[model samples]
Target chain A: MTNTIANIDKEEDYFLNLGPQHPSTHGVLRLLVNLRGEVVKDLKPYCGYIHRGIEKMCERNTYPQIIHLTDRLDYLSAHQNNEAVCLLVEKALGVEVSDRVKYIRTIMSELSRIASHLLWWSAFGMDLGALTTFFYGLRDREHILDIFEETTGGRLLQSYNCPGGVMYDIHPNFQKRVKECLVHLKKKLPEYDKLLTGNVIFKNRAIGVGLLSKEDAISFGVTGPSGRGSGFSCDIRKLEPYSAYDKVQFDEIIRTECDSMARYKNRIDEFYQSMSIIEQLIDNIPDGDYQTKMKPIIKLPEGQYYQRVESSRGEFGVFVESRGEKNPYRIKFRSPNLANLSALDHMVRGQKIADLIAIMGSLDLVIPDIDR
Target chain B: MTNEELKQRIAQLCADAVCTDTQDYVLAEIPANSLFAVAKQLQEQPDTQFDYLYSLTGVDYNPELGVVYHLESTTLHHKITLVAKTADRENARLDSVCELWKTAELQEREVYDLLGITFNNHPDMRRLLLDEEWHGHPLRKDYSNPQLIVDLIK
Candidate 1:
């Protein structure tokens, strides 16, 4: 059987389509993989399946209206997306948000980061056939969602961020609920390590798979945990502190291994770092108005404004080119997922077909983020 | 280097390039023909090693097409914005920096797909977000598909 298999396609490479609807893809991403037997010789990712022309739409919409569209780009990191737009508009208009607003935004951003990471963990575990891990991950994620729904009034697509500040003040129980959720997550994160991180089967499949060097990570513009895994210190939060990131004291998680397991471990360690950030800022929120006074009709000065935030997956940048109108001349989002996904083909080459799933899961791509 | 030093350095490097110290970043407007060379200098020079190309965007300036590149030096922690505009909109073309920064490959394709600006020497210069048979570049100001896009603002 082995001889016959080898003789059948000794020099020929076969192609396989892995996604566009497959469960492992996590979204509408299609990978055309060329395989020589089980080893993947080349991989090409075809995106834009969920392209809603968000950039084109932004040109037609006003400054305030554009915030909602950002939420749909990286829905998992919806708060961060909204904040990127708000920060851009605020900077363009020269509006200084109150300290209270800054602290609240930072805390909420960290909460959403935890929530996004949890969902990624659940889906990644499911992709690798660890069914029990999904339930464990989502069970802890619920507390964060509950906190979001209570304050932002939306579970997933929360467009809470406005140009001047958040849309509305936090709910009365926001602080207490956040503390409770943090307490719950701090206890539950250890269980996650025991379940998936230490498993012998997972280690064999993950360790040393999809080795992306530090040079490749920087060249491809891969940021967040995936970039940090390759020892590329590309954390926007640390480098260009936006919002209340300057006040927070948390270590930027970096792993020099440059493999799938390194990426996995980076994200796992980030859970503690995120929690620590939230813990520091949660109690120290100052007393002031949640929002500042702003003109009803928002129009940025005629110039280019760019703002970047450290989203859960990577650096989410909003570039606004204004023509001194209510609407922007051209708006482009430097989506982290798109940059991260661009590097997928480079990382997965020469690896087994099965390891592609592990590497992809480690990337934690949100397709709409890429498509937008 | 500070924005002033970087501006002077860039000015020295590219004689015709207009360098402005913007509020956020050092904005430099280079001629379309010399963009690739200036970018190469920006990347290769030890003092101005703008290794990371974070964002590449194509803009439709009515008759002229433009591409804006946001580059950063991870080692130096400074950013520079390069704007290159084509003289003719009909045949919108610019040099591809994918050789210098791999991030430009897909972004250039996106620019080509949406704004109709083709990147010369791009390995795979194909439509990214839109289909091949798509009639017009939807992001362009003049691109009007009455059947698809409704003029909500008007």
Candidate 2:
């Protein structure tokens, strides 16, 4: 090693390949980072190291069969993506979902959002150098997944959403188990705040780092809590009311600060909001059929339809162009992670190496979601 | 304003652009060249502050091509569908909305990478989610998978 170093010119700049393997990267993301003593001059995020051509696969599958593929896009919050696609197809076919189906889907989506944000909070803390919060966050998340298993029969990739409505009706004890799970999460979330949110070092590491102004955020099409942190009101649930969101009452959380801390605080705030939404929906489980009866051979009209829904990361849109066939003529998924990832080049332009990890965590780039 | 009034107003901006005016939204088709101007006007309007660019996607019309923009105004709470039709399949160049909405940049790149539609003056127009040496735009009808195409030739 010493001989090779001696043979190499001292003036040549060294490029550090940070990941597609680094633990702090959060996913299979590689950074071609130009460094000058830990200060990053240029950072390029190389993805598609995990692309599976999900869009092409969706084209081959039937309308109902594609729901399972959507489950894998953002696996951390599979229910949200699954519901997003199911509702798009339902809207396309002009199918009327039952009231009970709407309430149950609402409950499931919110629960998934809470689980995603909780994991993000823990992982974000760990990225900023706190290791214990990872275990704490995952411990609480396990309870939510257990509840999901009770209802959806799958842990992470819950293919619960179907075209007409859902795969099946909620289990009889679904409400009781979800309520118990909520009680446990509510108790554990406060401990998370105590462990991470108020920590002196965590605040110092995240505050004022990766400051995204409101104008910049809007231009970048950043959504979810990231755009909300910058004070752009981009919540699809609030903007375009889908499923049971119109009937439900919840606050559209916002923060005008537009910094890493604002982003962090927005997720923490969303955890409580998600819990509240789940509680309200679970308590008012309507009595009716779980799915609407539709034609066995489902064919979409020969036209273009675009539907957008809010996912855990941000606005997720499904654009389906049908040629009056069982399968979509052309389908496009505008996953929020991809849109949010676009701002990374601008966001991490002047930050340090350590700051890069913190900012990347704040952006929450799910690699498959981006690649798909 | 009601959906009718918004449609009428957009008609005033581009006569006969409104395609179908449903109860919820008004769909309009603008010339590919006029998309940027119409989108800018929508953003500048007091009543229709379509400041948020929700989604941008390209649709293939066998002999022709089209780009669709779904826009909404958070302040006004109105939704509009703007369509831009290219002259033919060979050349599908539309004015970039990146100057008006930043979200359009990545969206335009995706369309370029997938559908082979070029966005003039896009700041950093490059392959977003694909490899740099990837052969053809995957979403295009004529596109053949590199591996499959290679296997066929052999």
Candidate 3:
């Protein structure tokens, strides 16, 4: 047999357009990649296919009205975005939120973080070829969604977060139900570990797939678990404490491997960390007013305010420019997915085409988050 | 050092670069040419090791354009912001910070794409998110949003 399989004609370098439609690309993301046999030579990410110009649209809406819009940016972590925007607006307005409200917000945010990570781990597993993990992960996520639906009246886009505080007081059964979910989650995590974490196939596909050195990770602006996976200092619920995060006690997990598997394990450890935070906050939720009294029509001073919070993906930032109006003059979102996706070319430069999907899954690019 | 002492130090170091001073943070007005030297000095200072860049943003000051860098020291836990104001909107050039912080490369691309601010000596200051054929900077205040009306075929 010849070194190269002889075709009828000449062998041309094959180029395949992955998708603005494939499941692994997340939402409406297209990648034009050139392949040398099974190895990818070059990759160009084509985004903004779902661009709605949410920034421009926010300028046209009231500050309160725009929280609904932010929910759609990172649909999985809608609560976190809502909280971040609300925190900025509240800071601008100089309204002090009550302790009870703070605890509630903190609990909800941690729960949302767990849900988002579960979805990510599931998808990451599926991309590595463990299809059953995807279904199992979402099945757990569905329980969290039910809790969100019961409290916020929406599963994906919970406009539940307002400027002063949460939309309403938690229902009587909310705490009980959330506690039960936490218990269930704690019990379910070990099964997840057995099925996916311990599986050799999953480990081999992810172990050293996309390695980001610590310095390079920081330089490239990678954050959250991805950064922690590279041995960067712990950031979440620790540095820049928001809500009741300061009140909770939990260890920030870190791994120096800086590989795809490290990120996977970082997220799994964070799942347990989040559960610990949620359990502590939910049990000791103080009985008090859920929201502080503020003016109906809120206006911010003409200046610039920057707020940063640790979202499920990474450090999510909101830079709001106010012109002393009810609406923002200009609001810019520093999306984590954008930065994570930007590093794709660096990560996938020498990997095989199959590993490309796995790397993309590990980065967890929700296209709306990147394109918005 | 406190903000006052830090201000005094910066004022002495680059007398003309001190734009505004506050108790918590200092805002320095840096020229395009002197930006790199000033940034290097800031990193070298023993007390002030602004090794971490918190955020880099662009501001559309209409006729006068500007780019701002919010810098912080992880060890010191102090923060400072530097604003590089440009006189000519047509040119709107500033020194690149990729040397100080590698994160600035993509950030500079974002500022260039959204605010139409150019960075001198930037490695690749290409359009980041939007298409290259896109007509104007969408973030500019003057960019208009046109309303489209649909005609029913049925």
Candidate that would win on lDDT: 1
Residues forming the 10-long window of minimal summed lDDT in candidate 2 chain A: A7-16
> Per-residue lDDT tens digits of candidate 2, residues A255-331?
99887889988898888888888877888888998888878878887777777788889988887878989988888
Q: Give lDDT tens digits, candidate 1, residues A129-237.
A: 9999889988888888888899888999889999888988999999899888888887888889899999999999999999999999999999999999999998888
- Candidate 2 residues lying further than 4 Å off, grouped into runs, are A1-17, A34-37, B15-18, B22-24, B149-154
Residue-wise C-alpha lDDT for candidate 3, range A1-372, written one tens digit per residue:
564556535656778899978888867988989887788887877777887878879988988898999999999889999999999888877788999989988888888999999999888888777889889999999989999989889888888989898888888888889988888888999999999888898788889888888877766677888888988774846778988888878898889998888988999999988988888888788988888877888887887787788889888888876788888877888788877776777788779999999888887778898778
For residue A195, model 3's alpha carbon misses the true position, in angstroms, by 1.2
Tell me how each candidate scores on DockQ against the true complex: 0.76, 0.46, 0.38
Comparison by TM-score, 1 against 3, better one: 1
Stronger candidate by lDDT (2 vs 3): 2
Docking class of 2: acceptable
Answer with 2 or 3, whichever has the higher DockQ: 2
Rank list by DockQ = 1, 2, 3
Tens-digit per-residue lDDT, B1-154, candidate 2:
6777877887888874856753235778887776777889989989888877777888776667778888887777888888887866676787888888877877788788788788888987787768889888777777778688769889
Candidate 1: TM-score?
A: 0.97
RMSD for each of the candidates: 2.6, 3.1, 3.3
